[model samples]
Target: MFIEYIAQAPKEHQKYLKKMYQLLKEELPEATEKFSYGMPTFYWKKNVVHFADNTKHLGFYPTPTVITAFKENLTKYKFSKGAVQFPYSEPFDETLIREMVRFRKTELEELQ
Candidate 1:
């Protein structure tokens, strides 16, 4: 489903979406993946995050808890209660993305 989703997305967006997928995959090697809300999502004990390609930005959904915790570090981008929009213009911030994923992973790990 994830491969099909990416394949059907616009040509220009595929690269960014693929990068997001790889980053998340690397960070959560143990996670199970599937399509959720029509977007690629990763889950461990529960849904950890989802990322999608938008017209002008890459949407990173790190759940509300992860987003709130990293709000300070994400001032430059647009973020809501549950997601962050990293603009296509700005260089992709891999480090920040990894930190957010790790934080969510830790939170989920501690829950059990």
Candidate 2:
């Protein structure tokens, strides 16, 4: 289903979505993949992150707390309370993404 979601993305955005998927998976290997809110979602004890491909950008949903926590580092990208839009024309900040995902994982772990 995860692959299906990526494959169904706009042709121009598929590659970016795939890269995002890879980065999230690498950081949250123990998370289960599912379709939530109509996007590809990764869940551990709870939802960890979700990603969707848009016409011009990849939508990454890593919860509002993570967004606020990374606000300083995310200044270069477009972001909101719970989502960040990484433009298709630019390369993704792999390190930031990995760190964000790891941060989410730690948050979930703390809840235990």
Candidate 3:
């Protein structure tokens, strides 16, 4: 489903989506993939993150708690309660993304 979703996105957005998919795949090796809220989602103990291609930016959903936890670092980007918008004109902060994903994974682990 994720592959199909990527394939159906605009040509220019494909690379970004693929890169995000690879990064999340590497970060969450044991996570399962599914479509939730019409976006590609990664789930471990629960939904860890989700990403989708939009008109001018890529929407990254890492949950509200994770978003708030990394609020200081997200000052440069546009973010809401549970989502962040990474513009197409800018490069992705892969390091920060990895850290957030790892933090979410740790949160899940501690819950069990």
> Which candidate leads the pack in lDDT?
3
List runs of model 3 lying over 4 Å from the truth.
Answer: none
Candidate 1 per-residue lDDT over residues 1-112, each given as its tens digit: 6778788888878887888888888999999998788788998989999998888998999999998899999998999999999887777899999999999999999998
Spell out the clash pairs found in candidate 3: none
Against the reference, the lDDT scores of all candidates come to 0.89, 0.91, 0.94
Better structure of 2 and 3 per lDDT: 3
Which order, best to worst by lDDT? 3, 2, 1
Model 3 lDDT-worst window of ten: 83-92
Residues 1-112 of candidate 2 have per-residue lDDT tens digits of: 7888878778888889888888888888898999899889999999999998888888999999999999999999999999999999999899999999889999999997
lDDT of 3 by residue, 1-112 (tens): 7899999999988898999999999999999999888889999989999999999999999999999999999999999999999998888899999999999999999998
Indicate the TM-score of model 2. 0.96
Top TM-score: which candidate number? 3
